[model samples]
Target chain A: MATVSLKNLTKRYGNMEIVHGIDLEIADREFIALVGPSGCGKSTTLRMIAGLEDISGGEIDIGGRKVNDLPPRSRNISMVFQSYALYPHMTVRENLGFSLKIAGATKDEMDRRVAEASAILGLDELLERRPSQLSGGQRQRVAMGRAIVRDPDVFLFDEPLSNLDAKLRTQMRTEIKKLHAKVKSTVIYVTHDQVEAMTLADRIVIMRSGYIEQVGTPDEVFSRPATRFVAGFIGSPPMNLHEATVSDGRLVFSAGDSLPLPGQFKSRTSTGDKVVFGIRPDDFYPTGHGLSSGGETEVHRVELPVSITEPLGNETLVFAEFNGTDWVSRMLNPKPLKAGDRIGMSFDLSRAHLFSAETGKSLRN
Target chain B: MKGFKPSAPFLLLLPAIVVLAAVVVLPLILSLYSSFTPFRLTRPETFYVFVGFRNYLSILSNADFWWAFGRTVLLLTIALNLEMLLGLGLAMLVEKATRGQRILRTLMMFPMMFSPILVGFQFKFMFNDNIGLVNNALQSLGITQDAIPWLIEGHLAFIAIAIAEIWSSTSIFAILILAGLLAMPKEPIEAARVDGCTPWQTFRYVTWPFVMPFAYIAMTIRSLDVARAYDIVKIMTDGGPAGRTELLWTLVGRTAYSDARMGLANAMAYFSILLSIAFTVYFYNKLAAARAQIGAEW
Candidate 1:
């Protein structure tokens, strides 16, 4: 395993720059996931690291050696593509041993390595089977086996689990995590799925519009978002931000509802400053005795008309409207709340987030 | 039975059946019946006479017929193999070219655009004895002091016909193989490179195997086309002064129309059909095997 460092890494296609001067240091044996929406250049960044794409301007150092000019093979990196990309003609044995054979490994050595990889992946029985004969999950395993047999310094995955079904994706996610743990190799995985990034990454790099929004641990990024984009992107149902202004040391909503600001923002903002209050769906709870009685617990209460209720067995997702803005709240033991029903809900202001309305930057930062 | 009846399909197929009976079925039955009789085109009254396998026996024993048959096979083998090799080389080179590829492809197809008869005449004039461009150029370069008997010599004439045939049809192979190259998945090739395969190794192990099926398909199609090659050879040498380049078709034409021995010619034509069938079946089986190697159903 080796540490990978990208210094001022930039990628441009003609006049339009995709990745704008990204500088990151991935430590050895650390699983760093690059997560973003489509066209956010997450995959492009991984490809540049893999040497599949040329770095327009930057230096990529692997283990203290600059690998900007090196080919993928020379860099000693293995990439598992999103499509699996197994040779359709070769059997699983050949597929796993292809790199070894090309590198001039002996027949005995190839067989040993292939056998070892197959055993690790539980593919010993599928050595003679072609890729077309394998199921989707089995093919995914074969693809991983191909990469593992190489035993490169860095493992690059390009949304490898996106093709599987939901359950299979979850199972393969765990398998990949276990494999990474066993190998202890530095891995750079790229995916748009925040859940995958949250679960698989030791450090998650959230990217937007080719720029790094936030890079932190899952809990850090979830609980302490650095930007409005990260606050809105890293969560499942996402954080809801409503326009508000600080008036007389209190936050005033657009719909005439007023509540005192949380203590975290007391020193950051002055009166009459415009800001946005952000709250996650799960951060809201059913109000008890109104917001005034909850001392030291900064709670803001609001009455909203229920738009829809989605029951997901354990918790119910309640979609409600406030000040013409749709917001979702997760409630425990939520019954059949019909549409147009006005319900009083309380937001936990201590868990709430604030961002500057004009700049889209976190106000608490 | 009532539920199974579909009168619409049968009604729709009625015209096709009638056309097939009139155009294909009736002619096939007539030919088979005529093969049993001593039918001569000039003497139509002889059609009623039963001859059994007399025409077949005559063709079987005929030295000229067997020689022409063997010559056709030789021409087919030489022309098809040369065309395949040249076509494969051209396609590989074209596939590697990044710029001006479209222009090169279009230029390569220039030969295929020409009629076979026109190509034959062009080559014939270029290879003519005294006043031809080839002879004049050779004399001007002092390579040869005298005009070479290009059309008279057996081997030279055969080579000339084969060259003309190769030039005219090599594009068919190139285009088909190029299509295969375009359709090939880029991932395996990239993987092969990352696997440390050299350019030659990648082509040998990955690229060539993928294109073999396409090459076989082109070969099968061109074999049938070249097996019936007559326009060029007829215009160039007309089976030569001593029948040295006597192919099956030329021999059959001489016997059928010129000598008016229709029965013998029909017998020769029927036998020659075996050559086409053999090649078509052989290449088709190879195509199937190649596809199977790639785990494709077709």
Candidate 2:
């Protein structure tokens, strides 16, 4: 197990600084995921830590040892690539045993480790097959087997499941979670999928434009987003964010629609202050169908004309016009509803979020 | 004529068939037929004298012809292998170059641009025994007291011809292998590094196998080129100094032109064709195996 520390880690290609100075402390065996949109430097930061990309000015300490000048191999970390970069010329057994062979391991040790990894990944039958002969999920398994065969101090995954189909991705996600539990190595997974980050990472580091927007537990980032970006980014159907001016204890939108400012942000936000009001689809649901956050549930009900209703078996997603834009509300024990129907929607103000319009920082102290 | 119509495809292919027959089929048939007869270019009457297997039988017992055949094989073997290794090195060097890669690739192909006959003449002058550049450089550098006969001596002549042949065609391997290197994915190399493979180990295990198919293809093309090697040897040695450095092509050329033994030369030329066929088949099989090893379609 290793604690990875990034102190002012920065990466600049030529004169274009891609990953700005970002510091983070990953505890031993902590599965940290760097999640962001494309070109947000999450991958760059991971690459810098892996030593695949050069760090412009920073210190990377893996297992409490400075590794700024170390090559990827010297750092004793294993990486699973997005393409499942198994050696095409080798069989599955050979692919798993390659790193050991390169390390000059004895034949018995190599075979033992290869067998162990294959058994763990359910690749015993596929040992003789080449990567091209295997399916996408099988190839992904072989890649993970290759990494675990080394028994590295840290495991680095660069969108390893991005290449798999949705069903297989979910299957492999569980396998990876189990694998992480079995190995218990420090993992730094980089992915653009927020759900993958939330499910897999012990802590999520949300980045935007080369800067770390927020770093917290999945629940913390979701329930209490530090920035307006995090609130909209971390959720499945993304939080509904609307620009508003706090006036007379009410958030007034540009379209003259108003919401009573949540009591928690009363001390942080004042009248005439422009802010971005945020609420999740789960928090804003049909009346009597809303879920509680277990604290004081100060919910406000409003009737709005439904624009569309998406029935997803158990629960339906109702899209309705609010503040001159579509605000999605989840209907638990969903009732039969259609477009043009006026339904009372509940807004969970206790779970609501507010961020300054000038700076997207949250107004909840 | 109204009822039995000529096939439309055959009619369309008529001109190409006629041209192939005239240029390729006619010459092959004429040569095969002539090899069975005691045909002499100088005496037109001897062309009809049926010799049956006389030419083939004579060549089987001829020590000089066998020696030339052996020498030709040796030259092809040595030249093609050395060219492949050098070309691989050159391609890797160019691939690693960050800037001016386009210019470097163009420059790398300079030797390939020269006609083989021109290259033969150029090397012939460079390897001349008395006042050649090689001996002059060796003597001036005090590496040799006397002039080293680059072309006159048997082994020296073979080496000189091989060098000239390698110089002209190494770029063929380089260009094809460079294309392979360029098309290779960067992820595998990075993965290799992450898997604890040293740079040399990565090259040995990953890069080399990926490019082996391309190298074999180059070998196949150059093997056919070198198996029928005639121009460089003709220009440089011409089976000189009691035919010590004589190759099959030089011997066949002399027999066909100088001795006026067209039938014997045709038989020898047919034997040389067998050598080319053998090398081509071997390289093609190797190419297929390499492609298969990489899980690529043959």
Candidate 3:
């Protein structure tokens, strides 16, 4: 296991720069996930670390040794591709032992390593079968096993679960997490699925347009996003933002209604300044009870027309329109609320996020 | 039922079937029937006289016919194998070239575009003993004082024909193998590199196996083509000085047209069909096996 660091890494395809000056320090034995949308350079970043791509500018140090000039074979990193690129002609056992055999490992050592990896991956029974004879999940296991037998300093996975079905993806996700915990090897995984990032990563690095948006623990990024982009990207049914202005010591919406500002942020901004207020869906509840139940602080209230109610068995999602913007709220025991029904909702302003209107930066920063 | 009518597909295929019968089926039946008779082109009535495989018996025992048969086999083996090897090497080299690859591929196909008869004439003139450019150049450079009998000697004549054959057909192998290289999945190669395979090791384990079926396919095609080769050899050596390079077609030509023995020639043609069938079946089975190994539905 080793720490992997990228120092001012920049990737350019001719004049267009894809990944512009990214610096990341991944500690030893940490599971870091690079997550982003398509064409966001997350996969490119991982490929650069694996030495599959040339480092246009920057240094990649694996275990404190710069690997920028090394080839992928000499870098001693194993990668599991998105397509589960198992050798079609070789059997599962041969596929698993291929790296070691090429590296001039002894026959006994190769056999032992292949046996151990197969047992760990539950692939002992299918060792004699070729890649064409295996199922999708089995092929994925073989791909992983091929990497496992190499025992490289770092493991790189490029959307390894994307090809599996939903149930299989979830199953393999947990298996990968457990495998990481068991092996305690430094692993760098890349995927576009935020849920996978949330569930699998020790530290999640959110990327957009080839730039790192935010890097933090999943909860840290979820509760305290660095910017409006991070705030909107981290959660399911993302955060809602509405246009508002500070007028006469009160936050006034475009509809001309006044709402109370939190005490900590009240002294930060002056009157006549335009700002946006952000709130998560699960932060709201059916009103009449104040924002605070025990010792928690109370905040503001808004009355709006309920647009739609979605019942998800345990909880309900309530959609409401306020200040000409649609907002979704998570409620407990929501009872058949129909469209055009007036409902008073309460919000805890202490947990609310505020952003500048001009630059989408967080106001608290 | 009163309002039903037939479809247009049958009507569209009726003309093709009629054309096929007239062009292919009729000639095949006529030749098969003539194989059983003592047919002569000059005396047309002799075609009806039943010979009961006497022509086949004579050719089967004739030293000249068996010698020609052996020579044809040897030519096919050497020419086809050499073409495959050279083609495979050229395709691999071209595939690695990042720049001007398109132009290179187009240039590689230039030899295939030339008519075989034209190629034969060109090489025959180049290898001619007294007035050929090759001998003149060698004599000018003081390499040899006398003109060599390039088309008369047994081994040299065979080598000359093989060289012509190779130059003409090597492009077929290269084009087919190039297609295989282009269609191959790049992921496996990347994975192999990450798995610590050296360049040669990667080629041996991954690239070669992926392209074998293509090579075999090219081989089968070229084998059938060379087995029936006539135009080029007919122009260059004309089965030559002592019939040293006599292939099946050259022998059959002498029998049917020059010797005016149509029945014997027909018998020879029928026997040679076995060579084509054997090669076709062999290659077909190999192609099937390759597709099965790769788990592809052909």
Candidate 2's DockQ = 0.86
Work out the TM-score per prediction.
0.88, 0.96, 0.90
Q: Report the number of backbone clashes for model 2.
A: 0
lDDT over C-alpha atoms for residue B98 of model 1: 86
Question: CA lDDT of each candidate?
Answer: 0.87, 0.92, 0.87
Q: After the best TM-score superposition of candidate 1, give how far the Cα of residue B36 lies from its true spot, in angstroms.
A: 6.3
Tens digit per residue, CA lDDT, model 3, A1-365: 49999999999999999999999999998999999889999999999998888989988999999999988899888999999988887889999999998899999999999999998899999999989999899999999999989998899999999999999999999989988987788999999888999999999999999899889999988888877888888787788878789877777888876677656677778888888888888676557423335544755676888888888876677888877767878777557678899988977777888877777777884
Sorted into a CAPRI-style docking class, model 2 comes out as high
lDDT of 3 by residue, B1-298 (tens): 9987657997798899899999999999888888888898998999889879898898889999898888888999999888888998999999999899999999999999999999999989988998888788999999999998888787788788989999999999999999889888888899998988888888988888888889889988988898888988899999987898899988999999998888889999999989888988998898877766665544
Over B1-298, each residue of candidate 1 has an lDDT whose tens digit, in order, gives 7678758989899999999999999987777667677678899987788798899898889999899888889998998888888998999899999899999999999999999999999999988987778888999999999998888898889888888899899999999999888888887776666666677777877888888899999989998987778899999999985888889889988887888877777777788888889989999999998888787755
Candidate 2 colliding pairs: none
- Candidate 2 regions exceeding 4 Å error are A292-296, B1-15, B139-145
Docking class of 3: medium
Q: Which rank order by TM-score, best down to worst?
A: 2, 3, 1
Note the DockQ of each predicted structure: 0.48, 0.86, 0.70
The better candidate by lDDT, 1 or 2, is 2
What is the alpha-carbon lDDT of model 3 when measured against the actual structure?
Answer: 0.87
- Candidate 3 chain A: minimum summed lDDT over ten consecutive residues — where? A287-296
